[model samples]
Target: MSEEEWIVDGIDHLNYRAVEGVYLSELNVGLKKLILHDYPELSDSSFVSNVHLVKYRLIFMKNVIDKANKKNDYVRETVYEVTKNQAYETMDVQEEWDNTITFGQKIADIVARFGGSWTFIISFVFLMAVWMAFNVLKPFGLVFDAYPFILLNLALSTLAAIQAPLIMMSQNRSSDYDRLQAKNDYRVN
Candidate 1:
């Protein structure tokens, strides 16, 4: 190969003119150190595989560029820490959120689950039937809530008011968890 076509390090047989070519020894010292620290296995070999090294280098450079463009030090540090710790693939968003939730949030989730089930619908229908039957069949002038059933309406309204907020809370939590899981998945990929 011509002198101009060869890489500066001459370790890997990669063509300098190749589209994605990158030599391990030719990379920035800090970037190489970071990669080596993150992946100790690569440090053991004098001539790291060009393909693997280039892939990691590209990823590192992309992350660095993105963080720099965004002007966010925290994001850059977080990316570096995650890469170093190798925890991107093992992240469990559901388990993490579950562990951090309060007792009230748990109760809201349970209540929302029950409220959306067929059992709740059937039981509620049966109770309403029984309530109306008793009120209608009671002796004259002795009925607590007659035809209009003001008491039953009040109870239903109160239940709706309370259950609506609880279900919304659970749904909001679920949406947040989904967003977190998606972010983790993106990082892993």
Candidate 2:
């Protein structure tokens, strides 16, 4: 767009305006980033700016294809066709769909992956049972803890208070690792 933005040595060396009638995929990498900024202009009536960006990309890709066609024409042609058929609208739609699917799948995945963690549940149940058993069996002389057992109560309360957070810490670390694995797996494909 500005004279200062032009590059002649790398991608900046090629004059995009020199091939104004080309398609989108042929454009060079630098020009591609430049053109990506004008995606919103596709809806305009004239479409001159949008067309120019697409043409630059098309030209760049075509140049690469020309050099490599003799050794692998089929691959080059396929690449060219795929590139040409892709437009800003198609890319935008794919991006939106990817975002939606990612969010939805993350929710489902988290639930399905670690939702049944039993440690927390078991600890909670055990803690409650300890309290109840102590109260219920007091008259039976199962006196591991006796009436007004302040020391026993203190020990139970302290263990519960400390152990709950430790269990939570372990759960959190595993969950974090699982999430990291999921993210890496998604990216690899």
Candidate 3:
């Protein structure tokens, strides 16, 4: 126990001097007001110990945290109430679009799927090799199209003209599907 005694401001009279003291004017205004607690006897020129000031700081921090927690709880409750009262339904965009897809669109999607695959690349390379070899080598007098293969060039140009539009159509439908999915998600949230 401390043998020395001191009167601390903002709090009740103290009998021990376990900690040092500071002038009330040395503290920040907010901290000073918090400790004062409307005690009329305290003044700006008064003196208080470090222990009492630290205790009041803890109290102030607790009050602020409690107020923030209460606000968070209110927000959580509001969100819960809004979600509970609403009946929400989310739809699968792909399934719904399948029901409405035209035959041409379906064909385009199938062609697009095949065109983008490794199988298409490997098979296309094999076919081109066979065509060029057949034309250049004459293949035991079986080649009707000779070197610089005009017929093969014409076939490639026609395939490109047709395949490009089919791929584009499939991509356009895919974007529309994504838009539908986004709209469905917006509604659900």
Candidate 4:
């Protein structure tokens, strides 16, 4: 590719002036595709992959190119406004928060974070002590979770299952945000 190729990820808007055999419309299509695939929620408008979006951007770009070739000042201004508007419209609601949040799910978040090897070992030891205490204190019959604490086991199992998915969801969101930020930075330079 030539140094003249304007590749903007998002910064101040990608602008390339002069030279090139490639159609700006094709370039825009590729860009939209990248955005849609990388960010699924952004494509919810049912138009992110629409041919019209590509055509609109291309027509605006072509207008600017034609005017620039003809040394027309108004053409540059017109294309700038039109292209900017279209691009903004396409980008407005591209962020999707599908599996984002809930209030009482904090327990899931905590379990997901500390349910690793070390945590499991520590919990096992703690449960063991609790079980021994229950046996020793059985004379008083005050053991809430006794030797066969099926309910307690079920609760932990359920927590691990739910928390695991939420943690994955959070990780995915972080990855997406990082990608979006990187794209924005790329566009600027």
Global lDDT scores for all candidate models: 0.75, 0.53, 0.82, 0.55
> Model 3, range 28-135, lDDT digits (tens) per residue?
777777867756578887778777777877887898899999999999999889889887777877789889999999999999999999999999999999999988
Q: Which candidate comes out best when scored by lDDT?
A: 3
Error of 1 at 177 (Å): 0.7
- Model 4, span 1-189: residue lDDT tens: 565655332222344332322332344564555545545444332322233344545766776688688877677778678668554322221343334445534444455467655977798789867776776578676766666676678877986687678778656655776676577655543
State which candidate, 2 or 4, has the greater lDDT.
4
Q: Candidate 3 has what TM-score?
A: 0.66
What lDDT tens digits, residue by residue, belong to model 1 across residues 1-189? 333553422344344443334444666776677667766554422344456566667888888898787877777887788689664456777778978899989999999999999999999999999889889999554778888899999999999999999999999999999899898888776
Given candidate 4, what's the lDDT at residue 47?
A: 26
Worst 10 residues of 2 by lDDT: 40-49
Q: Rank candidates by TM-score, best first.
A: 3, 1, 4, 2
lDDT of 2 by residue, 37-99 (tens): 546343222223334445666866776778787659777787779768654232343344345
Best by TM-score: 3
User: How do the predictions measure up, each by TM-score?
Assistant: 0.53, 0.27, 0.66, 0.34
Better of 1 and 4 by lDDT: 1
Clashes of each: 0, 13, 0, 1
Alpha-carbon error at 11 in model 3, in Å?
4.9
Off by over 4 Å in 4: 1-128
Q: What is the C-alpha RMSD of each candidate to the true structure, in Å?
A: 15.1, 17.9, 5.5, 21.6
